[model samples]
Target: MSLLNEYRIRLAQEQDLRAALEMKLQAWREAYSSFRDEGFFAHHESQLDQQLAWWERGLAGGAQFWIAETGDGKIVGLAGGTPTIEEDQDTGVDIELGVLYVLKEYYGTGLAAHLMDTVLSRRDALLWVLEGNARAINFYTKHGFVPDGTSEELVGSWAGLREQRMVRKHG
Candidate 1:
């Protein structure tokens, strides 16, 4: 069967936390190595505790996470958003798109766009793309996200890797 044919997208549960973290760590290591310092790949190992904490927080809070998995149960991509209220009275009810990724092999299959559309369809949301990641910036801009003047990324022990925030509005 074709690789795309066996892929599935579904809401992630607590049971999927470990695998999901592994997927994130692996993908990040591979993708961000260039944008980040060279030593990150050697030191940044996937942490089980971090994954457990994330699962706990999502279950306790109203956060939801989605994962795209293969028929054999391998996590290929993940996208998550959370309920947040911004200070601005103009835009009430906000959801932040926290994560979106696909394995290298599926990079050109339109998975990221599909995931963003799926998430954004639920509400007017905000997300950020790394400044150096041209591909992601292009994808977000093409989908109608605009610059919101926010750029504070949580770079883990790496320099020059930060976030540039963007938002999408429906008139």
Candidate 2:
């Protein structure tokens, strides 16, 4: 209740990896439990290793990491930006909004919006939301992300699900 209101936001550091990753997994499990199969959640541990790899890269890449933690240092949410400086086949510089996860307890409490607002405020960037994830699609729309008519299959087991690429440019 009031305790949740006192949460703070800051850049995530190396030591926060364990808490951050755990928060991410908890958020995902809660968000997609209804949409995905029971077997999916039951067999999801292998995916954690892959996620750990990416989190490690984020730690090593020096990209900005933002986290929302309670007064007790419990991480409730996280968001980050992963940028590609190299010229791409399509867009010039690709800046990916790579992380946005909030614990289930905070999902309806505006924490998602808060994390997203902070992420977008950092810079102009693009992100992909799985087409099947209706909740995320609506969330991104409210944040000023409109469909660019571009999509792709996200690598890995998500290859079947369409990934909608949306961008917000700041002038």
Candidate 3:
């Protein structure tokens, strides 16, 4: 069977946490290594256990998280969002697309779009993307998202990177 045909998207379960974490780490390394300082990843690596715990806790709390898994049950992509009331008040957006990531090897395979479509489901939502990530910006744009002229410099250990907000209206 084709690789695309072998994968399925479903709501993430507790057992999928480790694979989701691994996919997040891998996607970051592949997508951000060129522009992000080593310290950024170092911080993320140091927080792996904490992130895992957070994932478990969030899952237990009934948060929305989904994963694309292969026939062998290996997760290759993940997407998640949460309800937000104040962040996009001016635009009337109620959901925040917190994350949408796919393994590097899965790029150009329609998996990211699939994950995004599944999460947003044509709802009005907002998300922030690192300013220089052209690939992500393009992907979001292709999916009907447009920049709303909002930008913010990241703080803490990732102080130098800038993030831009993008919004996809209900259609």
Candidate 4:
């Protein structure tokens, strides 16, 4: 059977935090190795524990985190969004797609799209993607998001990386 057909998506809980973090790490290692500088991983490694805790707290706080799981029970992808209003009044977008990552093994199987649709559910939203992440840019574009001309340089743990904002509007 096709890998795409062998998986399902559902809301993520506190119990799924560690596996979701692993999937995020694996996806980042595989996908961003070329897009990010050589020191990216080394700089970010020390903060992964904090990120994991943040994910757990976000879940507890009612952020909509979702995971894609294989029939055999392995979690392969995750996506989440948060309600946004005050900070993005400039764009008028009310939601932010904060995280979307999938294991490299599922890159071509449409799992990322499925995970996104599960969490965002076609809502009009905004997201920041790494400036040079062509694969992600293309994917978001395919889903109707367009660049909104905002960019920022990440500092500290993700120093040297840049990001641009993309937005999709309600139809």
Candidate 5:
């Protein structure tokens, strides 16, 4: 059997937010450990309650989230998309691929693509990715996204990192 068969992807429910967020945290730790220190992760962890509450509100406000989980129900990946909130965007696409994350162990297992399809099946969309995240950038590129020459420097705890906007325009 294929390895992808061992996992399932489905729309995330209210109760699934915490696990999805936790999985995302693990993914961030694994993916960005080379650029960030333990303090960054700890600071993020300390805001867990606020993050959970924000996700709860987003779900209640109609944000869509999809999660990949094992047969035993442990969340391993998550993806979410919503209407673009950037007033300055001239990409001509309103759908934004907000988040896509999978545990490092699941890399190259096609789980990320599945999650991407769940949230954005061939639609014209846009997303902002961290400048140094080559893995994510390459994946997005393979899926038809390209940088639109727009970029921004993140503020607060994520200060220092730059993000570039990518857009996939469907003909």
Candidate 6:
């Protein structure tokens, strides 16, 4: 039996935010451990409440979010999409996939893809990914997203890393 069979993906509710955020943090820690130290995660950990509040507001405002959980209700993956906030975006992409993360233990189980499809479907969308995260970049590329040549320097605890934008357009 496959691990994917043990999971279900559905729209996230208010109660799921904390677990989803913690799972996201774990994913980040696993993915960036090579270049980032404990301080980086510690800074993010200190801001969990702020992040939770932001998610609450976004959810209240109708931002779409999805989570992948086990039968026992352990959240292992999450994805969210919202209207693009880039005022100068020229591609006319209206949706921004702001988050898509899965626990490292489930890396090849297709849970991430299920969460992504649940949130994004076939919409024309854009997402910003850490520049050196080849796994994420490749996954997005496989899902029809391609870099649009836009990049930005991150600040604060993320100072050394950069973000690159990728987009998928539907005709």
Q: How high a TM-score does candidate 2 get?
A: 0.81
lDDT per residue for candidate 3 within 1-171, as digits (tens), equals 555676999999888798789889888999999987787787898898899999999988889798999988888999999886575677678888999999988898899988988998889889999998999999999988999998899998668889999988866
With a 3 Å backbone cut-off (N, CA, C), the pairs that clash in candidate 4 are: none
lDDT of 3 at 140: 91
Which segments of model 6 are wrong by more than 4 Å? none
Q: Which residues of candidate 1, in runs, are more than 4 Å off?
A: 1-3, 85-93, 153-159
Models 1 onward score TM values of 0.83, 0.81, 0.93, 0.90, 0.96, 0.93
lDDT of 6 by residue, 72-138 (tens): 9999888888778865267688888988888888988888888888888888989999998889899
Q: Which candidate is the best by lDDT?
A: 5
Which pairs clash in model 1?
Answer: none
Instruction: Provide the overall lDDT of each model, using Cα atoms, as 2-decimal numbers.
Output: 0.73, 0.75, 0.88, 0.84, 0.90, 0.88
Task: Name the top TM-score candidate.
Answer: 5
Model 1 lDDT tens row, 97-141: 778887777776877776666666747778767888887788788
Query: Between 1 and 2, whose lDDT is larger?
Result: 2
Each candidate's number of clashing pairs is 0, 0, 0, 0, 0, 0
**Which pairs of residues collide in model 6?**
none
Q: Which residue pairs in candidate 5 have backbone atoms (N, alpha carbon, C) closer than 3 angstroms, thus clashing? A: none
lDDT of 2 by residue, 1-171 (tens): 554586888888878877788777678688877656666665665567677777778679776789999988999999977674453225433677877988877766788777777877746677778787888888888777766778876655444567787776655
Distance (Å) between predicted and true CA of 137, model 5?
A: 0.9
Ranking by TM-score: 5, 6, 3, 4, 1, 2
True lDDT of residue 36, candidate 4: 68
After superposition of all CA atoms, the RMSD between model 2 and the true structure is 2.8
Please give the distance, in angstroms, between residue 30's alpha carbon in candidate 2 and its true position after superposition: 1.3
Root-mean-square deviation (CA) per prediction: 2.6, 2.8, 1.5, 1.8, 1.1, 1.4
